[model samples]
Target: MCEAVEKDLYAVLGASPSDSVQQLKYRYQKLALECHPDRLGDVCDSEAESGRRKFLEIDAAWKILSQELQQAWPIDSIVSLEDMTWDHDECVYTYCCRCGGQFIFSEEELPWRQGNDDEKKRNESQHMVVCCDTCSLSIYVKLSFV
Candidate 1:
């Protein structure tokens, strides 16, 4: 099923479509705090409920905007051709290719994060240790599927 995209968040947050995720997040947080319900109550009793609703709206908008921003200005992901290797017999591979300390997988058929300890251990073992070949230092990697 197709999900409905929210078109009004830009106007609600007073942000341009091109605004970076960080920019959107900062703007939303600032606006949410400025229009907090409790703060609004002191100014106008009738506007308190309205302010609360807007706050919720902004929170929702922030969630979507942040995701979009991350996609646009993704953390540096660099893979070096020389450092990647494959173990065809085990259907496993390891890489020293990444510039930043992160790993990403493109296999859509595999189930990644859901499993028991034995499965976890098995998967961990399959992963070839990836590290900075230049520094020979291991960097922390964040995993995500696209």
Candidate 2:
């Protein structure tokens, strides 16, 4: 796993995070429509590569922010207790992966609070806390099953 990209959601869509979900959706839709690979004309090798990369990033950003999507287990899938490890020194529960992101908590912090109903209803919403060791970017994923 890679670290969280830490992209400002606003910057990704060229709109503010405070923007309504409708606004974000519209912005993403417009970018996707305008930048579709099919619309890019034949071009030099470098230019084509750049266009392809941008299109892929845009599609990924949209998927990350889209209302219809939900978080799945990380590839390699942490499905059981044995899959996780405790970092006694850090006092955090860290996953073994390329990114090294940890669930920052003491035993006191166990049973992290889940998101509220409204947050779930609004797909634009996110969990309150998480961080990426790779980018030092904070994010929230709906966690479950270990």
Candidate 3:
């Protein structure tokens, strides 16, 4: 089975992780319509097979992206890494939540934190989900290493 982490869902959908859910949906739908096997009527065998594969890929991408969207939809806000305050003592980044709570971001949660030195050197940006310590609200923290 293909793991979600093994495949770049955003790349499959020709999207960026920073893209809004609505943007992702639009891109997915456009790609799906273009690659759908039914739209390849009367094509050669190879062409039809290729279309089927592309359609399946688009479908899988949508399924995964949609699931992620659903999971992140409840976030109270999106916070940029620079906007968060870093605590040298606690060694964690924090953002103030509206409910008098704090959204804590740790280094361990970073996507590129586990790889080799070369991997760590290649700058990339992505979002991490963090929940308020004192409330039900969560925030999407944008982490960048540019």
Candidate 4:
């Protein structure tokens, strides 16, 4: 049995986070064709198994990327604090995004946000973290409620 794990699906598909939906689909298709086991009619059994695994990974990545869409408290780029890599400089908290963009959440934007950590945790939380200005990718920062 195969269990799904949390992974950087974009990396699996050889795609950047900001790639358009069309671009992502294209990449998935290309990888899918390349990795298809049938493409290797005379390969060894092990190689065929490897190709099947590769195809599954590519297909799953596309499914995840296509489902989600979304942004900020002056976050400059929309994203969640948790999904980001934290960096503290002076009074600012900088979050390094997955798409290689930075979302700046300063103390100034704190007031605009909901509440404290406890309250935020008890309730649901989502933030649109922007990936990069060059492309249209946003990090979906979501905390699921239990």
Tens-digit lDDT track for model 2 on 41-139? 887878778878877777777777654322322222322333446678876555434457543333323222222345443454322233333433333
Report the lDDT tens digits of candidate 3 across residue range 1-146. 97666778899899997565545666787798889888888999999998899889889988988886667547898888899998999998889988898877566445455344364333543666676777667787776665
The C-alpha RMSD of each candidate to the native structure, in angstroms, is: 14.4, 14.3, 11.3, 15.4
Question: Candidates' lDDT values, in order?
Answer: 0.52, 0.50, 0.75, 0.58
Q: Which is superior by lDDT, 1 or 2? A: 1
What is the overall TM-score of model 1 with all chains considered together? 0.44
Tell me the deviation in Å of residue 3 in model 4: 10
Q: Best by TM-score, which number?
A: 3
Stretches of model 1 off by over 4 angstroms after superposition: 1-6, 43-45, 77-146
TM-score of each: 0.44, 0.41, 0.49, 0.45
User: Which pairs of residues have clashing backbones in candidate 1?
Assistant: 80-97
Candidate 1 residue lDDT tens string, 78-125: 443234454565454345434543332222212332233355544543
- Give the winner by TM-score: 1 or 2: 1
lDDT of 4: 0.58
Runs in model 2 lying further than 4 Å from the true structure: 1-5, 67-146
- Number of the top lDDT candidate: 3
Clash tally, candidates in order: 1, 0, 0, 6
Candidate 3 global CA lDDT score? 0.75
lDDT of 1 at 105: 27
